[model samples]
Target: MDKRPSVLVIGDLMLDRYITGTASRLSPEAPVPVILYQSNEDRPGGAANVALNLVAMGCDVTLVGVIGEDAEGELLLSLLLSPHIDTSNIEADSQRPTTSKTRIMAGAHQVARVDREIASDVWEHHAHTFLRLVRKMLRPESIGGHPFDAVVFSDYAKGVVTEDLVRKAVENARFCGEDGIPVIVDPKRKDFRAYKGATLITPNVAEIQLATGKSVGSNEEASTVAQDVAERYECSVLLTRSEKGMLLCDKENGLKTMLITSRPVSVSDVSGAGDTVVAAVAAGLARGLDLEAACRHAEVAAEIAVSKPGTSIVTEAEIIKREAAA
Candidate 1:
């Protein structure tokens, strides 16, 4: 923990804008309640949020992804370009606007959400720039070692994460050492195979069901499904079950899978909780912690994340404070 672990984050990056206020009147044109706009706050979202989470964990972070040639993109950069984070690899796409999600909150309740993005494959728009940067990061220098201690593939199913990218990143990353650094993936794509060779993949109940068409109604069933998927994909599985906590069926542990139960708390919102888990786990690994230890710590971090509203951040100090209190 003395040194900051360098982490590379590659995936779809975006901005999250929150509009919080009180709503008392119904809209004259529609039946929905009208929300009188109060104040708006913008934060890094998607993969950008992952970078933020890592930086909060005291990691030296580098972000690589596509952004729009727009004001929103500029705002995102301003928020994320910090002393702890390197944003040099992030590229801009003129054809598409920056991906942004605007959420309207009526006090504690979410009234509505508006998203601005092009959901298609963005390879045509940013492949050349992305591939070049990725390869550069992956390439080994003859000096000390690889720049990163961990690599995170935060796939939002946007055009950024590709099958080719995954393979190449892992392939070139082996130069870090004989064992190579841990490759952690926060997968959103239905087909789990695209994230093959990752050290671990964090998926929730719905993602599990969609990827393998299996029922996760029970703990035993969920474990079986997770083990199968992990085996099929040739990586470990860290299954995040909202209230039930998380299940870790790691390939590194053979047939052993540990399910860490969630601590009882008031759940606010589940959005971006998985990102916290990914960041915590990757940070733990970068700091020389094993996957099991990483996941246990990540569970604590995620529990903290869900207790707060919106795509908020969880820091190492906060997590340490929480553990001390516990």
Candidate 2:
């Protein structure tokens, strides 16, 4: 890890379109929900948000993901380009549409929402193209020929993070082990099998419970599952327990778990907090921070993320201010 180390973000890219309005009156046309009557905002989401957070934190970031050539895709690219993050790794697929999650908010409350996206597995040809794009982005010429200090896998489980890509990346990271590049995964799947060799996997309480088939009624249960995952997957884990905080377990460190509490905050929206967490951890580790230090940094970043509205992007200054106060 080095100061100002570069990071690479891979997985799904999506647009979070928020339609905010007051819902005082119910819609007669639709029996299901009330209609919103105010303007809205759009933001980057999924893997794109992870890159945005990294860029906002002043880390040189490269985003590799698939998006359609549709309007949403255009918006996603435009948003990424406006920031300091690099979009050279973004690949367009004509066959699929760019994923978008639209939330209709009535003032501070969510009224109704709809998701316009696809969840099919990546076709073989497109997978190959994405692999090529990844290889290109990792090349020195494209990204300064320097190896990324950390690789963040922000999996929304929407299909961009294919098995082939995961295998290739893990193998590459293992080969560069002494260089000490940490590969972090923000996993969505119930099974941690696919992300076997990742340096760190961040899964929420529910995800951990489902993945490990262990009931998580208490911290004791969570601790047990954390160690179970670490030993079974042969990797470290940072289990996020929402209000209960997080637990870090490393196989090398045995079954002992380290608990880190999150900074209390008035949560406005938790849409992209996971992305922020993954970004902060990756950035911290890449900058040579210890695992505990990195998890704390991520927790602070997540607190900032939750305080903002919608799929908000946490800035470096905000994180620094929170850190100072903490």
Candidate 3:
């Protein structure tokens, strides 16, 4: 862990816009709260937020995804550029507008949201360019003869993370000689098989149920379903169970599930906590922590992330501080 661990992030990227104002009365046209126009703000969302988390934890990140040929894309690119984050692989497609969610907040509550996006696979040229970039990064001689330590697939189901694309990416990353790069998935796809050759999959209770068609209301149920998905998909499972902590099961450890308990705190908005969890796990693996240890680190990172208001960044120092107190 002497040098910075370089990580590659690929998936769906979106822009989160918020327009907050005061609400005094209900709208006459419809049964909705009337929000007085105040101000507008935008933030990098989805996979972009995952990149933010990785860079905050001191990892060098290369972000790959598709955006729109619009001003929102321009603003998102500006927000994503940093000393540690390389946004060169992010493509801007003219076929669709940038995926964006604009929430109208009345005082402290969100009244309504407007989303603009097209849910479809990446266009042919975009897909080819993405594959080329993936291949380039996998090569040891690509940039400074340094291959990525880990790859994070932060899927938001916005059509960027296609099955064929994931298959090719996983194949290349898993077979690049003896020291294979780890591919971690923060999956939004209902089929876990789409990420068959991945090293780890981070799914919450809701996702676990949908992916496996099972009811996971209790810890035991979650364990059963998690194992089913892990073994079936040929990948390890890092099930994030919110207040119940996390469960880690993998073939490397004989599928012995370990529950990494969540440190209880005052819960705020859990908007982008998953992005932080995936970023922390990828960064932890890059820094040489085993799966269980890395998951423990993610538990602490997510705890800190959820305690803050809306989607917020947690720094390496903050995580270290929280761990020391624990």
Candidate 4:
């Protein structure tokens, strides 16, 4: 029997394109510098990046999201089709363009970014289809009586994570029994109510303030806010504070809060760091780690992710090496 944990990632999917060049001179018409065309590369972004992170950590991952029937979408799918990842649930819609972020990089620094996407909620039929897919994936008989261990909602506020979708997913997970699978959400919406009933939520300091209108500047403040949010939502909350580390408040097993301090490392690009955190945490939970231990694993994963340039992922071997070094 294959006992490896399986994770289902659902939400916005995008492609990140990087155009690297040298900007030695300014433009003639405007003040912007002229980027000497050098090289360009594309990688999976958004929810797809989360799936990648999970796969790199040795988890069986299934990615579910909406993409357009366009070239960019094809490219994104191609990049995501890996031996450990199942993309059978990713659907294509012709009415919308695939979400993409094109960054113009001058050497190692990003000068500007161009985004092409539709911010509106997915069509009703699409949402219905997505819900059906989720139900099927959660059904034990769907995969020879082996169900997913965890479900992650990687919301980028990019239209795929609707309120209905979140609610339905939670309900379906609860219906499966076995104490119900853990539903984790990396929320971006201003309204925290949309993510209610999730087993856990990973929100950064800025997101907490934006969603709850409470500024968390100190460790004490972060603890208070995390507790308040967890109580309000009746779920655990992992509040990520850059540099200060992460504060986790688990409501499921008493209102206990643990602050995992961040490691001191030379920071590079922080792009996709949140995705890495959520992915690591979800993989840990799926593998039967408690919330605090899972969060500590995430902290380490995030440290490794930010040390590299651009959106990056850490493999299980990298994590082991870091652990041995520590």
Candidate 5:
């Protein structure tokens, strides 16, 4: 064993269903497209995928979030139990429906997709209950009586990660940080403000544009946006620009910055790249790495994830081998 550290992942837990077939003709019954074949199934997604990546990287992971008491939720629970993950913090709700996204693909290309979820604002009562649960999970006596090395907020803008919930998570991490725990966030739009005290925040190009209201046209532009966000939120920021690579900025450390380009790889799909980045960052923090080193590891892990098909994960050994080859 490499003495991997324990990590806590919290946010949306979803099921991703992919329909793969051949689209050889148009529909005769309506003015629309048609598929000539059929194949489909479900896979872990959102924060679940993040946790999966953490486990693949030899980290002990515990996922804390909500899931519906439906068949999909049952399947997800079963899958997690099969792994070494500690799911004692996962809450199943009969009132809310499980979040699921279905993507239709023809060969390696995605054609269309549908999302079945509830995005309306969560009730205050539910938010209070969720926060209480989270605090309990982070207490000194929970989860083998040892505090987690880090916590990750893998928000997908779903209702599960409400503003109040995010704020509570930050406060909890602040308390943990006094004792040397790190908090990393993979944030979405509405709750970005809720992650003010995070140790690190990872947002993609489009998300950075939306969050910072800046058009990143060049390297300097990327640095400026990162600096703005880091200054505003009082935390380090990492901007992942798909093919263009990534940029990191930390205001406390003389506002240092580093840009990492994507390694050469066979392109197949871009799904779950953000999840992989957050996963790698969480793993790195747990293993006693600084924000820059964690972002570098995450960049390489995301490159590996994008090269594979459909919300795939990257292993630690695979990242080491790829970096060595590079």
Candidate 6:
């Protein structure tokens, strides 16, 4: 039997398209540069990116989210399938088009971004169906009769992760008994009340400020803010500070803060770095690592993720190579 950790990711799904070209002159119609066509690339985004990062780290991943019944949705599914991510629980919505973000890049710089998505909450029936699917996937019989080791909520505030979904997930974990799995949340909403009772929530400094109305400029300030947020949410908090690294505070640990310094690397792009961090942390927690160790692993993963362009994934090999070099 394979002992690899199995992770279930639930949230919004999107397609990230990069249109790269050369820009020599500005468009007469607008202030934007005229990008000469070069090439285009597409990759899974949002929660799907979390699953991709987990898979690259050699974990068994199952992704559940909502996508449209359009061609963009088909393309997104195809890309996910290519990575061997289990998309069996993804539901298609006919009322909205698939969420897609197209970045117009000139050489290495992004010139403009075009977004296509429905910002409203999913329909009531869709939410019900999504909850049903979540319950089914959480069952032991869903994947070779083995329960998932971890559950990740990758919320983009795109409406796939509803308050009911988060509540149901917590209830499901409780139903799993003593081995109650860890539920990790990558929160994006300004109001984080829905995420209460989760095992851990990984939010960046800016997100922390947005949710808690507190700014984190230094290590001590971040620690104070993390404790406040953790107490409010009644769970552990991993506060990701781009260059300053990560700060973790948990009530289980008596709210004693732990800091993990960031690894030195030249960042190429910060897109999807949050997803990578949460994925690494989830994988580590699923494999039974402590929060501190998991956060350390996540820091390394984030370092590698930002070193690449666009939405990228960090493999186990890359982590090993970086470790050896360090």
Worst 10 residues of 5 by lDDT: 137-146
Task: For each candidate, give its TM-score against the true structure.
Answer: 0.96, 0.93, 0.95, 0.96, 0.93, 0.95
Residues forming the 10-long window of minimal summed lDDT in candidate 4: 138-147
Cα miss at 15, model 6 (Å)? 0.2
Off by over 4 Å in 6: 82-84, 139-146
Best by lDDT: 4
Q: Model 5 over residues 253-291: C-alpha lDDT tens digits?
A: 977887888877787888888999999988988888878
Please provide, for model 6 over 1-326, each residue's C-alpha lDDT reduced to its tens digit, 9 standing for 90 to 100: 76778898999999999999999999999888899999999999999899999998879888888999999999999888744578888889999999999999999999889999997888998899888977776654434343688999999999889999998888777555356788999999998889999999999988989988888998889999898888988889999999888888977889999888887889899999999999999999988898888888898899999999999989978877876777
lDDT of 2 at 123: 71
Per-residue lDDT of candidate 2, residues 188-254 (tens digit): 8867899998889999877887787788668788788788889888889998877777888875566
lDDT for each candidate structure: 0.89, 0.82, 0.87, 0.90, 0.82, 0.89
lDDT of 3 by residue, 1-326 (tens): 47889999999998989898999988899988788889888888899999999999999999999999999999999998799998988888988999999988886577788999998888988888888887777765433343688999989999888777778778878655466778999998777889997899999989988888899787788788888887888889999988889998875887778889987798876878999999999999999899999999999999998998666788999999999999
C-alpha lDDT (0 to 100) for residue 264 of candidate 1: 90
> Residue-wise lDDT of candidate 4 within 22-131, one digit each (tens)?
99999999999999999999989999999999999989898999999999999999999788899988989999999999999999899999999998998888899988
Predictions: Cα RMSD each: 1.5, 2.7, 1.9, 1.8, 2.3, 2.1
Off by over 4 Å in 1: 140-144
Candidate 4 vs. true structure, TM-score: 0.96
Badly placed stretches (over 4 Å) of model 5 are: 123-125, 139-146, 177-179
Regarding lDDT, does 1 or 5 come out ahead? 1
